[model samples]
Target: MSDLRDAAMSSKAWPFEEARRVLKRYQKQPPEKGYVLFQTGYGPSGLPHIGTFGEVARTTMVKRAFEVISDIPTKLISFSDDLDGMRKVPGNVPNAASLEEHLQKPLTAVPDPFGTHESFGHHNNAKLRSFLDTFGFEYEFISAKEFYESGQFDEILKRAVEKYDEIMAVMLKSLREERASTYSIFLPIHPETGRVLYVPMKNVDAENYTITFDDEEGKEWTIPVTGGNVKFQWKPDFGARWAALGVDFEMFGKDHSTNAPIYDQICRILGWRAPEHFTFELFLDENGQKISKTSGNGVSIDEWLTYASSESLAYFMYLKPKTAKRMHFDVIPKAVDEYHQQLRAYETQDTKARLNNPVFHIHGHNVPTSDMVVPFSMLLNMASVSSAEDKETLWGFIRRYASEASPENNPTLDDAVGFAVRYYHDFVKPAKTYRAPTDQEREALSDLATALSSEEAALAAIAAKNAKMGRDDPLPEADFSDPEFLQAIVFAIGKLKEFEPLRDWFTAIYEVLLGASQGPRFGGFIALYGVEETIALIESALAGEFTK
Candidate 1:
């Protein structure tokens, strides 16, 4: 058996475990279709956002996990609810005034403001497809408009018509007294204004699958239940789609959690079971405010791609997806670092342990080897310290630290260095803070700078000083790869008791090197960025050049 198959069979990772649960549930009562369908719904109300990418990326991960464990043919349906009526113009899109002219019309019928597609819905749908395709997600795109217009939903529509009163009862139980009176499962598209009408149905011809409703002007009309003549209300529409499409698994945001029971009831009334549902919390901003597109308070997909890789975004989505996560510029470096960390871990972990690692699942069990010389956070600092304009400068430091590392052998790190350069310029450079060093701190920094000629000689000097002070742990033989060396430097300086607060010594180092009070672990930074370069940076800071 293949190594991946062996690991998957023996490991109890969450994705694999979830897949097993799904398979067992199906085995107990299998669908007539014999395969699973995973559906991800998108509303083409505005430009596809980062949240949209998260939904698809997460679903694709589960789908990949399912593929690994089972030979059952599976399909992911990227369904766009483009037939829903447009209530208002989206603030972010172009030509808001044009959209206002067609208020309440089905989105598919509204004219495209960008002139890139046939209609507003078509334009947004194209964008959604293009965006998902850019990530190379395997999904079949389905449009609600085309699904209804092509008679694909005819059978389910007829069933819903026959059970309209039963479906209405299920829907009305959840509504207030006032709303329950006017609620109708069927919303007929007005033949005159071409808008979806919410007016009460005059009568229902259950025998013939037809409904009679009055237009806004009180003109009476009757329409067929199928062929896009009518669409169900939101709750029933969700249920009808589940019944019609035979969706086996699907997920939505937590905002829809309360509606799940109602949707399930509606589905049962329509003679179909609701798909297995997973509700995930919404994405939040860095300050923990909920990200809302209308509020313009969160990052966009294009913005994230400007500074990080798509895989980094995927890694962000992979962790505890059911819990809310902050998606902002500040989260990028950590996500990139974690992605690289996982790649590095995958190289040395045993088969069972590898299965538990996210990179194993993120790459669909085909974890590729990497020779990353440094973490992303360190590279970001390196770029900042070196003022690197491009990859060459970052690579110079990389090659100095690890002579064998190169762009050709470590493509992931090479790409990350480029991203780090862009991120440092865009986010880090503007917020940098540098402080002038005190005389005593300056003296210590100067002494450290002299040792730049040989890192070992500097370690021995610090060790001898520590021994003279009768400290318990003196500096050990220099090994930059181990963080203990840098920690020892901080500890040895603290033993001098020059500063009241012991942390001040480390803080001094960070402020001098990064112009920030906190940064990458100093030892790791020096190891990856070379001792000579680190000494030069400290000397430059002491010379008042960095403060300028």
Candidate 2:
């Protein structure tokens, strides 16, 4: 049988598979060290949506896989095209209506709403960096404003301009075919205030990054610089930069696949390598519509961190092939706790069975189990129990608790600490949610408790009888001794005559065992936690309350 690692590396799933094939071809000959793994982001015209992170996260997965299989180093670059002028204000941002006059300026030049940064773009960029960092994602980030203004890409731009006609023709044809937008064969260049005409491309004179456009007839011209004079049109600028950077691979949304082929043509004209492509699908909202910031129908990444950890978010995004479906927060957060549990289990000696599977090794390492630390819920629980005012004490308790959860193989204490810190700093206490027990729930808990108690007593009695006969059987006594406690719990549960659906039994059991009315499942937990602790836990839960 093939090893799990071999099975996982056998193929890269779509839409990345196409790109991976190209990478594989290159791997046969291998690209240079520091092979580029690029993921691009548009200007922060508004808060970034989860779809934005989805693109980068999937690309990161591909990059990680490539590194593991081929032993080539990758620099996953995240480019923020902040030089792209703000096309429109996103709906949810306050005071968006008043920013129309500033639309054409580079995003870096725009005013900051939070007053912490010089401009709105910088502020949002900071938030994005923080968000990605929290998720433990690593990348080399470049801002377009800095790239253009610092002249790091000057030579590339000159080459692009030298092949201006060829690049323009390619882009124009692509726009017509794909976007259906007509172009006038004129590149918009800044004109002097008194200039009545524009300079033709070849004749335009540029001095110290400033350029003046003169008409074909040499009648009128305009001088423009970063703030004033010149602007590269959308699709063309993207092509020129890719050519400059020598990018080996880049991923884009499915919507861009049409124009993307055209950009490759521009790369050919500019005498630079075009990146291999991976086209990901768009994320849809709960309503099943494409999430759009401009349309005012999207959830931001920040909004999602409230309910789940970043690892869960990343795991959820790539659990299936990236192109298979659209994702939303509601679905992702629901599975995170269980995912965390699985990760913890895999770390233990008992985990050899579970972690040995091929599916667990897909794309990247099964989220390091030893690193599966306590979540916000566990951290809060520890804090509630701690006597010291020290943050480290809370963190220490979390690490210990998480270690106990996976006794055989555990993630490092550092990972536990890191997760705990992020949870404490980033999460808000959830609003009080009390689900009243239903009659059905009462009867189920009561009946199960009663049956469990009877079984326990019967086993104990059998053990006692065997002991009197000098049989000394160890099994029955080992399994059951506290029949009375089980009966008490069942009776207590039976008192609440309400209709609780079978589906919600887990929550009811959690409530009963943990006092918060929810901790883990009842039956499975009872099996693992043992009947003695289960009874103690239940009695403590029913009487005092589950604190930690």
If scored against the real structure, what TM-score would every candidate get? 0.91, 0.66
What is the number of backbone collisions in each predicted candidate, taken in the order shown?
Answer: 0, 25
Best by TM-score: 1
Off by over 4 Å in 2: 1-22, 25-34, 174-221, 224-229, 293-299, 321-329, 341-367, 370-445, 452-520, 524-548
Q: What lDDT tens digits, residue by residue, belong to model 2 across residues 22-41?
A: 45647556665456455565
TM-score, prediction 1: 0.91
Candidate 1 ranges beyond 4 A from true positions: 1-12, 438-447, 450-457, 464-491, 494-504, 528-530
Instruction: For candidate 1, list the clashing residue pairs, or say none.
Output: none
